[model samples]
Target chain A: MSVTYLEAIREAQTKLLREDERVFIYGQDIAGKFGGAFKATKGLAEKFPGRVLNTPISEDAMIGTAIGAALEGMRPIVEMQFADFSSIALNQILNNAGTHYYRTNVPVPITVRLPSGGTKGSGPFHSQSMEGLYSHYPGVVVMTPATVEDAYTMLIDAVAIDDPVVYCEHKYLYYHLKADALPKESFPVGKARIVRPGRDLTIVTYSAMVHEALAVAGELQRDGFEIEVVDLRTVKPLDTQTVLASVARTGRLLAVGEAFPWGGVTAEVISRVTTEGFQLLDAAPARINAKDTPIPYHPNLWSEHRPNRKSIATKARQILQE
Target chain B: MLQTAQRGKKSKKTAPEKPASKKGQVHERYVEAFRWMLTARILEDKLASLYRGGMIVGGVYLGRGQEAVSAACGIFLKKGDVFGPLIRDQAGRSAFGEPLLDVVRTYLGSVKGPMRGRDGNIHRGRPRENELAMISHLGAMIPVMVGKLLAKRMKGEKEFVGLTTLGEGGMQTGASHEGLNIAAVEQVPLVVVVTNNHWAYSTPNEREFACANLVDRAIGYGYEGHKIDGTDLNQCLEVIETAVKRARAGRPPQLVVAEVLRLAGHGEHDDASYVPQEMKAQPFAQDPVARTEKYILENGLLDEDKLKQMRAEIAKQVDEAVATAQQEDPPYPREEDWRSMSTDELIDKPSF
Candidate 1:
């Protein structure tokens, strides 16, 4: 079952809808008539009919409906048109969906997919990386897939988790890569994966940053610096041991993110490492992140606003005193 | 189906609901429900006394004026049925076979209480044995419950109908419209019970909703709306049973307006000075529980001599539960220990 990253996700969703009659996929312009703004859910509505629901411009209702359906033993996966629009539904997700289990012990199993991060020039309203807010909320399992395999498997895992999950897909990576047959069964959450191995430094990150870290590591290899990179697939149940162990041997750490450096996953990982991996640190831990501001419209300014592979390489050099 | 759009005035149906239950229901069950109502009333008043003392931690949201509203909606649930209740739904749970002891324990805030004392005052965690969980958020559970009812309907199961309770205060919440609108579209079985006590913590009902009756608000959603005399226990019983029966038949959703009054301050901590003096006297006339007791005596449903024994027995039961709850240790996170379970992600953690 060879497929592109985009098709891999679509295949997983299409197959799930076919196999599990209780599973539903719905949101604004997502049904077959509109085929989603990205065309990932292109033919789902025609195949499933009423099951592939098309929603109005209401995130609150869209999320609330999916939540209701999930509570009644029906598995519902809701796609927010853009990650930025999830603000309207954040109250439901933060106050109700995510916190339902810890507050009331009532299990609400639903998957919320956000076309997250930036590279495309959709402007601030349409293009924003807002995973920090979701990560800030407790009881939510957060996912930012870095590979085609992860893009496919995380959707299945998100549905299987007893708690609600926010599966953030980097929109830039939609047609960027391909892989053969993502393992469809038994994908686990809270587990990080080692994408590359080196001994001088550990590059810890997730989502698009995983690609940037890999590129930075490739350039650093010319300078005889060995970098170990681990992709933290899920941010909430952060895979601390795999990261801490890698940094313990490497003696240096660089956490990268495309989101704002302040209050992002970078800050979270740094705090964790300073506490759990304090002895392993050779130099003070550092993070490379996007400038602390709203993503702008101009292609040049947007390029400057994002933390790229160069930013990772420069930060790694600064930490290593290159 | 009676498809009229008026409130309470149902379209004249040629056939009334007659479920094929030839088992012949007992008369004692209705009497027992009346007894529970009486017990809930007296218990609310007494719980205030306990609140004033150090015996109770959180002040009770005394459902003093809305006792009959609870009684009417809860009486006839069978096994596998679920009720989504709000914070002040003591009478509703009591009607659903929840133990008096557990309710007392929850109110008294004991470690052995439901949800392990994580929820207090206005949340539901205990009484899992009855299949009803407490909805803590404001009208957030409406769509969630309707979705459940939708599932029951789609599967062609008569086993579950979502019984949801909210104060008229939360009626304006968006989830209410979303829940009711979709429930109507899909013809799902759901009963929305709004206890309009006329006060959403000092805001008048007139300020909250445009219509005088909350049931009127349900019309736009294609619901069969009813405005019942919440003070009239008999009327409440008849109307709620009708809604439940209609819901079971997949006749969209029904909105019931139970106009109630608050006999006391909202909670133990809330001062009564905020309430207007004239408003308090108005509901006293329609004091539902008092009216029911008078009717029970006038109708000779219970002997005057037997009433004394029944009151004494119920009083003893409530008092014992409260006493046991108080004597038991405070909740897992109460008193000196505000919360033993604060996650690393801090939101509302208590600090000394």
Candidate 2:
């Protein structure tokens, strides 16, 4: 009952490692020496000495190795110290790992997890929600977990996938959550979960945004505005049906995410809903997302860049009024 | 954005043994390697012709004088021993038993082509025969091969090792450095084959790097390195065998620098007009396929008539594969092939 988001992710790794000898974990500062910066893999290196690898300071090599290993029937889990640094291995991600399955017609079951989103006062390089750009690559699966249950459950689901996956974990969400006993068995990915159900307005979000949407919903509910929070667990192959169903029921939609406003994940959601679920929407989909600028170091500036409870609440009200 | 192509697996009927190689089989092992080399030479010559015409789009870096490297390597490689491919591995692919017609069809852009005609000559590889496609980006395959080698080790496959090939120019690139460094420290079961032709495009080896020979660089990286005459198929074959043996025995990687000559230009598109006519002509004197043919003919290993029969067989097979490939259609994938996939779909089942 005391499963934290970090613990759930670790439990998923442990379970997968124990069950599947093909699955392995590797990255810089990982392995037994450092346990990773966030302790996401504290015991993995010790538990599985040969499987857990600590590599040189080369992101391209790390990703390329994962792809190569995956090609040869071994599932590799690669961790980017931070999400934004993932750009260094962009070629490997898109060209090699993502396309290896298409080119060779063999599934390259490699998983890349990035400690992402704005937190820790680490400016530009550390705090980018690159969901939009990543979603553009074909043959890759992207995951963003909100609840601790999802954090644990989504990884099990990810492990079962035969293709490459880009799993985004918010740096802030690691220790700031708790859930019931995490599942050690297989789970499903690609389906969006309804985190907090409401009938007045549907709030579509994921990762840390789910928490923000729920917090805002709690404050707005006392004042008579019910909000449905939808956790879009996977970005690519988006759960459009859940979004449309929620939008149809609520008649108002607000996409909340800690990502950019222009051409962001929210934009994709709003675009899809408007095209298909146009008549059902009482108001045009409103996006309560991060500002279209690099995350600032200052706390308030960082807060300003990302959508918070007040912002989510304001957007929910605006949609209701419309 | 130089993107890597993606592929998913499918269960298919076991591919039949290629008849093209069977036609050239005269019963002896080394002679069989010579016949395979003849097939590669003819296929490569045909590809060179295709590039000269308007058919094959991206020209290939021909591995002409280095036929023995391909001939011997093709014979020595066993099941699960992956060949990472040199810029000139079209021969190696044929030797490793990538159905000769399929190999020819790949060069001809046929439907039966390795990548379903989606991949040009520069991007060819197959998992079935354990020969990775030819990657145009030099030295990029080194680290990838090492990683695969490590994976095989992890899977408890002791017989599996990686053979990564590159040009002499690749010795100077960061790819060679990083790849060798990682393979060295990790002791990845890999045989980094540096096919030193003594030139990088128009630049000579003296101007390219400080090291006199590419093998010296590997020794500095803390691995045993050997320099072998690329023209001698026996030498190259024996070198790879020793490296493979050492990798399996000591569980450490080795480097084999195949010293050959760039018998032609950098690619089929580039005429060797830039190369000093002397260098090209010198290496041509001891053409690998020719040298082996002479070895078999002069030593009474096989008469000229027998060699003639092998060449004729190789030519007929190449012609058939080329005709089939020319008639084959390009790959047609679904719309999802052009769109992003979800984690579940990427890992489990995405409607490909």
Candidate of highest DockQ? 2
Q: TM-scores across all candidates? A: 0.88, 0.86
lDDT, candidate 2, residue B49?
80
For candidate 2, write residues B160-206 as lDDT tens digits.
Answer: 66777777787776656766777766777777777777778878877
Q: Which residue segments of model 2 deviate by more than 4 Å?
A: A183-187, A260-262, B1-30, B51-61, B134-137, B169-176, B198-211, B232-234, B276-287, B290-301, B327-352
Per-model DockQ: 0.32, 0.34
Model 1 residue A75 CA deviation in Å? 3.1
Candidate 1's C-alpha runs over 4 A off are A32-35, A46-50, A55-58, A65-68, A103-106, A184-188, B1-32, B126-132, B154-156, B283-285, B326-352
Q: What lDDT does candidate 1 reach at residue A152?
A: 88
lDDT of 1 by residue, A1-322 (tens): 5677778778879878888877888678888667898887898899887777777676776777677677667788889989999988887787777666665556677889999888657778777777777888766778899888888888877776667888999888888877876674644567788899999989899998899899989999999998999899887667777889899889999998888778878888888889877899999999888897889888988887888876778889998883
Candidate lDDT values, in order: 0.74, 0.75
Question: What lDDT score is found at residue B191 in candidate 1?
Answer: 85
What tens digits encode model 1's per-residue C-alpha lDDT throughout B34-115? 7878778778777778778766676688777777778766676666566777755667778877777767777777776664
